[model samples]
Target: MKEKFNEAAFKERLEAQTSFPTLYPFKFIVPKKSLAELKALFPNRQLVFKDSSKGNYTSVSFQLMVPNSERILEVYRKAATVEGLIAL
Candidate 1:
């Protein structure tokens, strides 16, 4: 079964693990077709995309200077909206 991500717990963890204004790395694996929608989440940042060996999937990752846990969670919220996105 797929594990459910608890948004509240994750927000608390982010608060404990990182300080405000830190560089945060977001990672996700998604269908190649969803690339555009994913990139739209971080329009000002450069997203690194690595194509899967079979070329059907893409691994997306990026680092952004986030101001606080709230901002980090906001990114997660937007990311969750993408279809077939696997957060890592």
Candidate 2:
């Protein structure tokens, strides 16, 4: 027997555009303590948090609608210095 192809996943991959749309997911790691600060940093954006089992490290997953990647990078850079954050 032959394995079936994952057509849906392949289509999604092919359909991904070079330019970002109105909303997209940004996944990063941060310290548990700085989660509040991270939230404040993107007060206008919607956030979806996914907790990490690792000690002292919290996984943050959020979405940005029409965001500037430079601004996101700046936020990540600042978050990197928050004692225990390690962006994944």
Candidate 3:
């Protein structure tokens, strides 16, 4: 998946050594309707939402501190097992 960055924020974060940055692209078998579940699963992670289609689907860009990769992977793995979630 392609990404668009918040350049200034990314640069600042990178310089600060606060978080490891990565582009995690996910897929959803069904269009996203409720993000509350995802939010609950990742309370401290940064999540960026985007539209994949005007009226049908969506794509989410999730950014998290590098340490959280395992945690994030846990969430993604679980979600992927669910009816609608996928990793792109």
Best by lDDT: 1
Candidate 1 error regions (>4 Å): none
Greater TM-score among 2 and 3 belongs to: 2
Misplaced by over 4 Å in model 3 are: 1-30, 67-72
Give the candidate order by descending TM-score: 1, 2, 3
Q: For each candidate, what is the lDDT?
A: 0.89, 0.62, 0.53
RMSD of 2: 9.5
Candidate 1 lDDT over residue span 1-88, tens digit each: 9788898999989888888899999999999898889988779888898999999999999998889999888888899899999988
By how many angstroms RMSD does model 1 differ from the true structure?
A: 1.2
The candidate, 1 or 2, that scores higher on TM-score is: 1
Q: What is the lDDT of residue 76 in candidate 2?
A: 56
Question: Which of the numbered candidates is closest to the native, going by highest TM-score?
Answer: 1
Clashes of each: 0, 0, 0
| Residue pairs with clashing backbones, model 3 | none
Candidate 3 residue-wise lDDT, 1-88, digit = tens: 9565354664465456534455444444436665555556557766666766674555655654444345445555656544454456
Q: What does each candidate score in C-alpha RMSD? A: 1.2, 9.5, 9.2
